[model samples]
Target chain A: MRHGKYRFLLGALTLPLALYGLLVLWPYLQAFYLAFTDWTGVTSEVNLIGIDNFTRMWSDPLFLAALRHNGLMLLAVPLAVIVVALGLAAGTRGTRVYRVVYFFPQLLSVAIIAVLWQFVYTPNSGLLNGLLTGLGLDSWRHSWLAEPDLALWCVIAVLIWSAIGFYVVLFAAAMESVPADIMEAAAIDGAGELTVFRRITLPLIWDSVQVAWIYLGILALDGFALVQIMTVGPGGPDNSTEVMGLTLYRTAFTYSKFGYASAMGVAIFFLSLTLAVLMLKFTRREKVELA
Target chain B: MKTIRHTVLTLWALVFTVPLLWAFMSSVKTDAEIFDSPWQPPATPHFENWSRAWEQASIGRYLGNTVIVVGGSLTLTMLLGALVAYCLARYEFPGNRTIYYTLVAGMLFPVFLALVPLFFVVKQLGMLNTYHGLILVYTAYALPFTVFFLHGFFRALPGAVAEAAFIDGASHAGVFWRVMLPMARPGMVSIGIFNFLGLWNQYLLPKALNTDPDDYVITQGLAALATSRGASSDWSGLFAGLVIAILPVLIAYVFFQRQIRAGLTAGAVR
Candidate 1:
């Protein structure tokens, strides 16, 4: 019976495992190796140039710029998302109607969202500028996407707009799980609303908040597709919104430097892995002490 | 406090819906009207704009392509995902924990990490820009979450039901196909909607692996329309393409708002 059971287990797992390994894991392993080599994607030859690509990255201005943008987003996106999502989740009354509307952005593809927002940010006929001009605040309108100082912030705004609803629902779900009586009790005890939220609601949902930080952090790191379709140069006027994924992508396909691009991928991989572990460790330690 | 909350929520909802509403309205305006009166209702709704985007822009072609690819990938993902998830959930064997963790670990990998080599991989298989190639890649990419979600579902099912099926002389395979699979139907439907939306909305995969215009998916096609310089003057047509791309998702979200919400949030909250 045990033998037959093992047979069924192995038999069932074989095909899915093989597909996942071949298509996902194998390539990831190869990327780590490829990072060390100098293989122009066009070439049949792969020369192992150890750490050269990694060393070169520090001197590359574009790579440094990309890293700076990603880092800024890694800090800004999650903080902004949590604030708005937490507010909405805590404040909203009719969740049914609100959830549907708020989550609408999550339904559309990044491509569709990019295209839609591109129109919204259009200089002359755009929704933002049109509304501003209509309101007699004409000077407030600068080319939202075209201006170098503001372009990356514009991209960040879109990212925040698209992401907030999901986290709102996430935080709301966590909030809902807290006993209603606890909140009621806090109110009856002369606790202010802010005090109750801070002393009570916030503590209960800290875990979800932690998870959200990691999720949104990773998302912030990969602003590739959104930045690609949204910006004029994609990375754009003065490279203000250049991201790590975009840098890696252009390196491989546009410049055909597969090895150097693989090194960028490896860097992103480490960044992501570190973020995940660090969040878990940081949050888990506090989680235990809270209990 | 109550009034303040209501006011804030109302204002935020406007922020969410107004851009979409504006986009749909702009879709029907003449190109000149789009530039001149961006916020006004069109004098007459140009319904032909939708048809033009559908046929001329070949959004219809791209829609067809998306449906086929999403359908194929969704089916494969569920089948393979269910089988493996069910096993990991129920069976105990050597390396069971290892296999389960390894699959779940794939979720943490940003798809960007794999793109440079993943492109080469699909090309090596001579499968780039082809339907099956994309279907396979999508399935592989989707496995981690699908398995992760369905594993929870399978684990939550009572052990007694499967034990009864076995006593009735159902073989392992028979039990899984007939008894276990049906029992996991709710989980299937949840993750099914989850995967459907995900695979449907996929941008980077198709953008990276399939660039041929004929092979372009919805995202690629609409993106091409949006970015292509020749179509720059056709703002009405471009907005029409945007609205067309949005409508199906909008409709599905309306109909399946409950399942969609529950399906999407289940992983995060759990």
Candidate 2:
């Protein structure tokens, strides 16, 4: 415990510490500085612009749309992942066959998921359209990913479908980890399955739920690949599905506005960090009864 | 009630797996067959799609790149994480708690926040498209959970033994590397599986950093294949690429599911 004895321990930890500083902390600090500059990615000159980037972001319609898209995605994806995953988790608790089938999709990469759904939503030639025509509901089929008004929701739906399996498995594990004694007590008290879930299971796995929420928030902010692949760069038919990452991608790559992209990146970083911290604060260890 | 429950579960599972099933079926179909009977299985199993995808899409090169990045990242991360974890677990240094908490905070920071500046940092380091650059970044990003997970594991080790080693005048690094790390094999395995799976499966960072075909990781290469003109509608080739991309993760899950699941839930469960 003495300083002299701990020197070797400090030496062993130094490399990782330095790497973290250089790669994560330094970049994080640089991103904050870059946010105040006006450096297009293509140029070397970066002039100080103060809070202009942040100020412009506030009134920027595209930025607002991106935020709205994020809100919608967070609303839709997590809700779907939660509700359906819980349902599947409950139903497949004792079914080996169902568990394998449900968890199979989690094996696919997000790129593959995006591509597969892109085909499935390929306007007129898509499987959905074919099925619609076959069912004599041809008019009900629309340009799913090509319509400005509906593309964002459509992308959100695909994300929901792709993400639900992973969460289902996570929730199932959490639910199974709940001690059996409390469940039996609830059951003895005339609690049905739903009643037991509400009173006993949910409270027990509250930490897992909080973790899942934080994970989902980060996923919402970082999910640019799906928009990039499915929306083909404009985010959607009219940039409707442009979330923070996609906007950052556009600013950095498309517009070559390195400074602006860095600023957006910082915004996303703080947004997610604040949201995660708030979630953890609310779902503190004290909130769980552990009874 | 039993039959109804079985039926509902079966239906839900089947519905959920449709995309995966569709991808598999499409992977073996000819292009004409893909467009003509999109939902049907191939009349003739086109195994050539895999070969073609591997050859034309340059998946082999991408896989190689991925292996280096993922392997290098996991090695560096585990090395660093285990060391940091040992420091936290065994040593009482100034600001030890602060260091520990800061490491934990890194895991929760979203990747998006670091991407912009991270790109420039890598560029500045002349590691823009190199494996080392990505590996270093991955090690940093991956260190938080690695340390967090390994800290619990190291603390779980009996401190009396470490004290005995200290009494014998074993250097701190000697105790950590020679004694502690060997004792924490299970913890190391769990951390390895988690980090390997994560680094292998990462998409955005590779895509953002590496723009050229030669430097591309599997995820980025697969995306490129899917988006290219001749490549876009080639469902079979795309499926083939998907198969290649998911194979390692699937193998890992099959072999090390317990460790991975344990590692994944470590942060949340605690």
Give the TM-score comparing model 1 with the true structure, all chains together.
0.97
Residue A219's lDDT in candidate 1: 92
Instruction: Find the 10 residues in a row with the least total lDDT in model 1 chain B.
Output: B225-234
Give the TM-score of each candidate. Answer: 0.97, 0.92
lDDT of all predictions: 0.89, 0.77
Error (Å) of candidate 1 at residue B31 is 0.3
- Cα lDDT tens digits for candidate 2, A231-283: 75558677788887888877887788888888887788778878788768866
lDDT of 1 at B54: 91
DockQ of each: 0.76, 0.57
Residue-by-residue lDDT tens digits, candidate 1, B78-172: 99999999999998778989999999999877787788899999999999999999999999999999999999999998889888888887889
Q: Count the backbone clashes (under 3 Å) in each candidate.
A: 0, 0
Model 1 accuracy (lDDT, Cα)? 0.89
Candidate 1 CAPRI grade: medium
